[model samples]
Each structure stands twice: as C-alpha cells, then as structure tokens.
Target: MGRNTRKRRTPLATKIVAGAAALAVGGGGLVWANFYASAHEEHGGHNRTRSAAAQVATIDCPDVGQQIRDVPDRARGEVDGELATMDSQITDAYQRLATTRRAQAGDAQFVGNSILGPLKERRKVIIDRIQLEINRAGGRADDNLDELAGCQGRPADQMQNGGGQNGDGGDQNGGDGQNGGGGQNDDGQNGGGQNQDDNGNGVAGPVADDFIDINDVQPNSRNSRNGLAANGDGGSTGTFTTECGVNENNLFNSDNLIAAPGVDNGAHHTHDYVGNQDNDAFSSDQDLAAADTSCQNQGDKSTYYWPVLRLQDGTQEFDAGDQGGGAEGNIGKILKPAQAEIKFVGSRQGDVVAMPKFLRVITGDAKSFTNGDANANSSWSCSGFEDRQVTDKYPLCPEGSQVLRTINFQSCWDGQNIDSANHRDHMAFVQEDGSCANGFQAVPQLQIRLAYDIPAPTVENGQVQNPYAVDSFPEQLHKPITDHNDFINVMDEDLMNEVVDCINRGEDCQ
Candidate 1:
C-alpha cells in the first residue's frame, strides 16, 4: 500500500536450509541422490562418480548446520550483508540490460558483455568468497555452494575452452544441461502431438491440441468472438473503449515478474517485456510514473510485459539459469510484432465510474508449469482470419497466417486494494457464465493479443524442433504458453472522467 522500505536479503542461505530440512524431514535419500546427480550433470562434468561420492560423503545436514552455527555470528552477518549488496548489484545490472537501448545489431550482446557479464562474474567471485568463509568456519565448501550462490558451478574448463561457444557452454539447441533441451515429449513435440486439420493439413501444434482451441475456447462464455462486447445488464455492459498500441522498441528479460516484489531481476527465468520504460524488479511506482512509454497513448504510462516468445532456430541463445534460448545475449534480434493490441473493456453496472488508478493484477500464473493447473489461462490461435486454437503448446498456423497469443486478465475488482498479497486476490475472473462475483465490482477488463509470423515445430531426427518457443527461465516446463502480464494506469483525470462517461453511456469509443 505504501512505499516499500524494507532492506533486501539474499535467499540463498534460506533456500539451502530449506532444502536441507526437506532432505532431513522426508528422509528421501533417493530423492536427494537424484537431485544431486541432476545438479552434477547440469554442470557438464562427466566425472559423475567422483561428484556423486563427494556430494554424499563430504557433508550432511548436522555437519553443515553445525559448521554454519560455528561461524562467528558477526562474520555470518557480514557475509549476508555483502551477499545482499552483491545481489542488489546483480539485480541492477539485469535491470540495466532490460531497459538499455538495443538500436544496433550487436546491442544485445553489448549489454550482455558490458553489463550482465561483469555483474555475473562479480557475483561468482562473491559467492566463492562466501563459500571459502563458510569452509574456514568448518563447513564443507562445496556442499551447498551451488544452492547458496544460486548458480551451477562454473562449467568445467574444457566446456569453456572454446571461446566463441554460447555462455552456458551449450550448443545452439541449448546445452544438454538439466535446464535445457528436455522439454520435448517422447513424440518429440514440446507438450503434445501435432494434429491435422480436416483438410489433412498438419496445422496444429502442441499448444493447440493441449491448451486452447480458438474454435472451441471462448474469451468468456458470453463474448465468444474476439470483437464482441460483454453481455448482461447488471454491470455487464461495457461503456467506454480505449486501445493502446504498444510497440516493441526495446526488449526486457528478467526473472522478477511474480515473486520478488520490489527487487529487480529476481526471477530465475527470463521474461520479455514491452510498454513501460522501466519494468524490472526494482521498478517502483514513482519510476513507472516517470518513465517514458511506448504506447500510442503517451499519457497512459502503464507497463505491459511477458516472457519472450523465442523463435527456436539454432540461433537462439540463453543466459545463465535460463532453460531455453532467446533473450540472453541477443536482445535486439528478436523481432517485435507490428503492434500489440491492448484493449480495456469495462461493464457499466451502475453510474459512470472512473476505475481506480495503479490497479495491479496478474493473469495466468507463470509458476503453473504443470498441465491443468487452474492458473494456466494461456490461449493460442492463428491470425489472418484462420480459425484454430490450442492450449499448452504453440499453434501450427496455416499458410499465410500468423501465430497469435492472447492473454485476458480478470475484470472484477475488490474496489478497495490496489494490490493483494498474492498480487491476485484483489481481482477475480469474470465467472464462466460471464457475471462478476457478488462482492467484487466490475472494472475494465484488460486483454492483450500478440501476433507473430513464425512456422510450426517440425520433427528433426525423431525429435520435434520448434523454430519458435516461448522464452522461459530455469525450465522448459511446458510450451512457451506460460504467458503473464502487468498493467498500471497513469491516465489524466480528465481522460479518466471521459472513459467513465463513455462506459456509463454504453458507448464503445476505440
């Protein structure tokens, strides 16, 4: 509600402790072994025998906890303070990368090399120093360094021997690491098998078959078509319309979309962003209010961003911790759609009303990596007047049609809080039958439609290779259908009044 003034703390130690607790409480030795094996392999080290032995024999919970306890409290505090500062620096670097201008061919690379690269190196050094201090205080240095540092050990020297290789020491298809290339199913499709249309055209991809189908899925039960307005008389009728044409001038990639509130770049995965000039972990209300905008309605300084949809060509590259490629070292090369169609549709339940400003809401949970998670609200279809839709995978557009990713946000507001603890409680989706919940007030519903001209995933050597996929950090849990968005209204008072008037009068002014 008020400005966030709390100091930031690094969660590495806590994560390690929680993990150790899980291992202890669950007595899941096999699970721990599997996790260690996975982590070991992810570093690209082949000497799994030695690594596994070291992991099991070198340190146990009692040993680590005692070692941690043995450290002089003052020293531990100093290390934490230093780590927090380093974390802040790293976050700032990523924010810089997200907001930097990418006007030239190599601009993305420059940002990676000049900003993210140095910060990552510095972070490695700090993490190493912390590990050494913990070891000096009687803890095994390697026991939890990876978790504590929030990074895999630097790839073996042999992996880095080739200078021009991608940063994670993986190939163009992403390395064989745990976070890479494992998204495909047995059929080689990303999520599900491709489907053929009635004409026998193999035009449907995993997303279409699994997640959404434009032909079957409706925006809401009441408004099945794209341009149709909401129905009902008890505040179901939309009064005013405003469209913001958001251009992708520059791109943003960061992990800080949902979890970390004020900390910039806190997400473990990368997200592509557009709209507001400043849209990272550190972005504050004041900063957003002051930042320039890419929307045609310059007065509406709202931020709209989502994970980048990557063209899965061999050229895609990933940064550290990113599961798939795209939006890592190459920022500018990722093409932007001609324009993003952002529309606000509100129902006039009562008198003309100006919606609250700075209302924050998130649609489609990014953490819903598993299929059938109630939060998975992603939808995909084809453009160019074609009719096909799918969920959980990319759509196979017909010839001459483009790909479309549509995300719709909840429109019923609690009419009080601008944000809730979960960033969602203040808002609820319109009912499946298209009525606002009883206690919630109907606000302008926000929907975003992104169009891309890309081909469908194809099978190569028994494995489906997608030329395009959604960019995700950390894991290829599902097809890039993990879509989410954010908005902050910065309209002038007069404009707000006009919007309320337009809506109350049942007029659609686009």
Candidate 2:
C-alpha cells in the first residue's frame, strides 16, 4: 500500500467558514462574529492581539485550554486521571473498530449502524461527562462535544476514502477508491497496482494468461517437509545448519504494517503481524526489543508481516459490502491468515552470521495489481501439496485442500544501510541460481509462508466467479492475490548468536 502524494488540503478560508458555521449552528453567533472580526483584522496586518484571538477561535473546543487552567488544584489530579482514562478508552475503541471493520464486510450503513454507531454513542456519553466536569469547574464547554470527540459517523466509507479514521494517509481498501487504482507516495512512486525499477521507472514484465504453469518454479528435493520446515531445506545441508522459528496463528489487523521510518500508519491496508507485538511505523530497535513476542522463543523479537488474504465469502469475514449511499465493494475486510512460518536460511558455503538488528526489508510489491508490475517473486500454491500452482486466477483446490501464499525475501544485505530509499535497494534477491550478488553480504535469509483455509472460487456457467476479490487492488489483480512481506530484525544478541551457531553447525533445528 502506498501513501497519497496529493493531499486534500482544506483552504484557510474554507476552514474558517466551516468553523463559523459550526459556531452558528451551536447558537454561538456572537463568538463567530468576534472570530470573523479578529480574522479580518489579522489579515489586514492588525496587532498580535487580533492574531491571537483568531487562533483561539479556531480551536476545536474553544474553552478547553481555559477550562484546564481554571480547574481547582485539589481536583486537578482527578481531572487528569479522568482525561487519561477517556483518551485510553477512545484509543481502545478505535482499535476495536478497525479490527471489526476488517473482519466483517457489509454496506457502509449496516457497518455504521452495527459497529461504528454504538462506539460513537458511547464516545458521546464520555464527551458529555468530560464537558460537564469542565463546566462544573468554572470553564466553558463546547456545545457540539461529539464533533470534538472525533467519533467517526461513517467509518466504512472514511476507511476506504483515506486509510480509516486515523488519517494514516494510506488507503485501507487499497488505491484511491476509484476502480481500485494506485496511489502515489511522497517520492512520486506509485504504490500498489504497478511495478517500477529501483529508480521508479515502470517496467512491464511477462504476463500470465489465465494461470501460470507450476513448472516455472525450480524444484527442491527435501523431505520431512511439514510444520515450520515445509519450504525446502532452508539453506541447511550436511555440514551447515539453519534455525527455524514458527509463530502460529497470531492476530493480524488492519493497521498500517509498513511506512517510511518514523511515519506511523503508512500501510493503508490490513496485514498479518507476527513476532514483535508492538510492530508499527514508528517502531525502533529499542521499541521492538522491549515488546512482547508471539514466537515460541521469547528471545526472537523480530517483526514479520504481510498483506492478508480473504476468503471472499458473503459471510462477515469476506464481505466488504457497500457503504451507505450506494458505495459498494469489499474495502476493509481482509481475512486473517491461518498460520505463518518464519525461518533463517544461511548460506550453505559460508560461515553462518547473525542478521543485523532492526534490519528493514520488504519482499514482493503491494502495488503489483497489473501484469506489468506484478512481482516475479510472488508465488501461489496449494497447502500440503506444492506441485499445484496458480497465478492470475484462483486455483480450484480439490476437497480438503487449502490455499497457500509463500514469499521468500532477499537474503543478501548491503552490509551497511539497514534500509534504502526504495525499501529494496538495501537487499537484492538471490540469483535464480541461488548465489548472492557482488558487494552484498550473505545473511540468514528470512522466508515467510502463510496458509489460508478458503474454499475454491465459485463457478457458474463454466466460468469462475471472484467473490474473494481484494477491494483495494485493481480487478486485474485476479482474485485479490496482491501479496508482499516485510521484516524488521529485533532478536536479542544472545539469541542471534545461538541462531548463528546452530546454522554454522549445520543442524536443522526448529
């Protein structure tokens, strides 16, 4: 998912007008008149006093600052505690709403009436209580407290319009909300539905017809391929060892999973998260190292994640129904992955080494919706059976078979920068022949395989119907198979050392 480079900027005059209208509606005509006069004076190069007055009038809750100041010293702690609790509750509600929004699919009105409506009402009550307390302490409170509370009236549409209620700037439902098109990032890079070179140049690749031949992938001759080690030997051999870690059935949410460093909520879509429980856009090495872990090994604190794949049934899990007023589509409802397997595949010929901490890397392309930009590395197969592969169309799995989505990230690191401008420059995909490129260091390769228990696509009149479509991806994406993966290493030093030693010893440990 990409951030929208073009911002929807509300002009200063428009903001002023909206504020004035809100005031008038609240029977604060005198306040609006005073604000209008002060704004005009400031525009005419009036005194600083007029500018200050204009600024105060623009505050969402005009008297909040004064109310805080006027609170009696004896009750200040209690007020602070209540305010803190209110903020926490609101944060929790938003998180829950986001989860529900992604888990269930329906029209915007149904979603609003069922999920967002109750949350909004509860928030209103809290806001009213806060306002009453403020007034009781000799402070004026805004009449329209609901607006100040920022409770979303229509969350489904808003989430698709621009990355949900938090305004993370990424489209949760994928592109710009028009035919599931791509959105541009701040660097002029198109996010989702397209592929570009390292320099951001669009390069068209080979297009698959209805389906890709499973024979395209090279074959591996490894057995005992079950549980966490289902994807090849993981760079292990007679004298070299590789360690595997599995994080099973972790909760995946609709929160942003990737953004430029320091940018929070940059991913506008849903992603399954594993390892670090606190992984987010602002996550740092320190933050991740201190976070809780879902992995069996407590010392493995790295964050692993990828976009979610939904079943696309009419049930709540697959339904991105129409928003009220006729906006129809499955925008935010991305199904949680059934399971994820993580492993470190070291070079069979070299000394096993620890992966750099906080190493940021991305695999595949989230924007790869069209044939021109679809990731060559992206692969789809069937669970329990690797011989079956499908591309561009959903595979009609036999009864009892499940779908499998696998992504193998580049194992060669630049040995200097943890990340690059394009998020791919710092790492290079291992050559098809399985050799690291020049100038890149070979570290234990990180590979992720996700499984989903989804039924085969419905067919009518000899044609397959795509009910499990990715709402934010272009229709050309084909059955919503827009797959990508992200990794951030936060393993403790001792644990990394242990992993290195195990790999060097050529032991296959899980």
Candidate 3:
C-alpha cells in the first residue's frame, strides 16, 4: 500500500533565530563553559570576538533508574514511582534552563544557583525515599545513589564532538569518513542550540544541522544475532506478522506502563499505541490480559507504542496546552504513520521459545542525547534509502521517499523474570556471534517499522523550515537519537505457542 499523499496538516514556513551565547555546567561540579557568540565592535573598538569555552545546551543527569541494581519485588512499585518523580524533576529544571535564556546570559551562576541546585535537592529527597523503600523491603539500596543526584549542564558541542556514543569520544554513529560528518553533524545538532533565538521553536529541535541529505550517507552493514543478516534464512527463520492498524483508533498517552507503571505522564511525551486497547500508566497484568486489542488476532493483545512523530509546521495539537505536549516543548502536528508493521521473528541460531507473558521490552534510549548512546538503538532512513541508517541524526529523504523509523527489540531473555529493577535487565540483545550469553535463552524478537509521509524539511542559509521530530522530553531537544519503542507481551498461551511453533518450523504465519 502506498502512503496517503493528501495533506493532513498544512505545512507552515516558520523561521528560527539564534542566541548570542550559551552556558554549560558539569554534573557534581561547578564547571562553566560559555559558547562564543557573535562578536561585536565597541565604540572605536575592534571587532572583538566573545571568547567562550563551550555551550551548555541541556541538563545532563545520571540516569538513576538504569543504575539501581537491586530492589525487592515488594518495593519495586514505590522505587519506580520515586524514579519517575526524579525524571519529572529534571524535566522541570530543564524547562527553567531552556526558557530563561535571558537570565542565564545575565548571571554566570544562574543555572547553578537557581535551577540545578534546587533540582539536586529535590532529587536527593526522592533518592532518600527510594533508599528507605528498598531498605524497608529488605533490599540494600546502593550507597552510590547519592552520587547520581547531582546533574551537569552538558555542553551541546561536547556531545557532538563525542560522536553520539559515550562522552569519551567513542564512535557509535559509525565514524568512517564516508558517514562521519562530525564537524558538519555537530553544527547541525547544535546549530539550533547556538541559535536559541526564540523560546518557541528551539524548545523542540532538529535544527538545520540535525539532518543530512540521505544521499550523502553511505550504506552501513548491519548484522543480527547468530551471525546472520536481520532477515537471513537460518535455523528459526519464520515470522508472525500482526496487523495492527496505524493507530486509527487514536490510542495515545504519555504514560509508560513498563518503566513507570503507576506514574502519570511518565514518558513526558505523547505516544501512539497500536496493540492493546487498555494500556496506560496504571494498567495491571490482569487489566491488560482482559483488555481488548487492535491487533487482527484477538489472542495477540500485546502492547506496542512509541513517541508520536510531529511536523514542526506550527500546528497546535489537542494536547498543545497539556503537560506532555506544547507546555513541555513538544509542539507541532502529530503525524499518524502511513504504515505500521509489527512482526515477531525467530532467532538465527535456533528455534525460539514463547516469550513470558507480560514480558516488557524497551528498545532505544529516550534520553540518548544526554545519556549517551549506550542503549540507543534508533534506525532512521528514507524509503528508497533503507540500506542506509543513521542512529543519531534524522534523514532528509529526497522527493517521493517517505521517512522510516525501525526498532528491533532485544532478542535474548533471561529464563526467569519478566520484569527487572531497571526494566531492561531481563532482556538482552544477542552477542556478536548471534548467541545469547550468560545462560540467556533466545526468544522471538519483535520488530516495528513505521513510515511517515511528512513534508521534507529544507535548510536554507543555515535555517531549517518545517523540520520533523519525534515527541520527546524537553531536555532531549527532540533529537532523532532519542527515538524509541516499547512492547509488552500479553499473548495467550495458545497464540504464543503458535507463534513460537511458526518461527521454529520456518513457516511464515499470521
């Protein structure tokens, strides 16, 4: 089926301006780096450039949720709630930093004194509560949690200089000269940061420098576990395709049932859901099992969702004034996917077993911009250029090609638990040789492919118009690297067995 070309929302020619300066503060330390703004000539003075160390683009806090190694099952709920609160606290602090450009420029210690300081204190309280919960539940909370409380004002340029991997200058974005546009890419991602001329547009970024022409990128090779191509013919090669309409029912929310189950707006960004009908932050296992589904097979009531992609053409969505929408900096018209493909396929090494019911898996990192690409697994490309994928940058497709976002869930699973303290420990990707390490068992991997018919954004004279970005936390700045997907297996035993059978037998089944 072809994408609907009719315009759902008209594109607007919006313009953005740049700021004169930027500030940065390192986490747990009082380090400041100012960005060199445009130079000016004083009265009878030479054109003196404003010297600066670097530009602090956003707040970089330790992901406390991912660091906690142990939490008793009884206390998991309380700990999760407190962790979600920490996320909200950071969002609040980031909002202050992003909006108070004038004040930040005036006071050298404004960010430290007013924003980060208060944020750290609030986080400390939350951490204390979290520690108490764990200790009360007989689980020893790590003493190191205190170290994760303080956050730094990370420099935008330093992030790009690090090449989208670890902040230690690792090349997770594929550093080969053919695709590595570190210099140009840096300008693209931070160009808008440097040009924080307005409060409205810069709040959600993919500035002119954040996108590159798809043609300019080289086709990179990707291999799945078991030493086979992602779709290679091998041991367990069959697939089960579930037809879930492209969110036609309009199921949307900002709550994350897997990571922050009971916390409202835990994601802090609107998500488009296409599988289970009754999914929200407060949903329980019984609730999901009994709920209706959008999938073609009623037995397959699994939940699948991701951040809604939006066009920055100045359209005010229904949530425009709401917390996870415009108010938190995610403004623009939401674009329903023209195509949403959900499939579960077998591992390359051998037949797969049924995934534990209610198994939750999250692929990619929503905070990859500040958290680094350790868990980032975003694949962005255009229709015709599917061979080329970029993890950190959005692709600028040529005419006639639609934008595509692909997410492959972790393919290996620990034999026991369906959930974990960090929500990720139970799941693991296959090792380099395509085999599960540490006694982990292989399960059918879920893959989601979504295509969007968005008007390609254009960059002219260092300014972008009609840029498209996924809805994200305010501090993330809407970078494509932050694109992610989530899934929860709720398939009944009979259907799950069928899926496993099909994959192991090398038969494509629906």
Report, for all candidates in order, the number of backbone clashes.
Answer: 21, 15, 8
lDDT of each: 0.43, 0.41, 0.70
- Name the weakest run of 10 consecutive residues (lDDT summed) in model 2: 12-21
Candidate 3 stretches greater than 4 Å from native: 1-53, 160-202, 221-231
TM-score of each: 0.54, 0.51, 0.83
Relative to the unseen true structure, what is the C-alpha lDDT of residue 217 in candidate 3, on a scale of 0 to 100? 70
lDDT of 2: 0.41
Best-to-worst lDDT order: 3, 1, 2
lDDT of 2 by residue, 1-510 (tens): 221122222221011010111111111111111111111112121111112111111101111111233444333333433443333333333223222322222332332344344544555676576667767866665575455342322211011211122223212221122211111111222121122211110101111122222334334422111112212354543122222233343444333333323322233344566777776544556767898887778888777876655443323332121110001112323555566666676664465456788887776554333222223345577665575444333444556776677666777778887755335666776655455678787677776666666655543322233434332222112223345677888888887877777666677666
What is the per-residue lDDT of model 1 for residues 160-254, given as tens digits with 9 covering 90 to 100? Answer: 12121112221122111222111111122112112211011111111222222233433334222122233346553544434444444454545
Give the Å error, residue 19, model 2: 21
Select the stronger candidate by TM-score from 1 and 2. Answer: 1
Superposed by TM-score, candidate 1 places the C-alpha of residue 20 at a distance from the truth, in angstroms, of 20
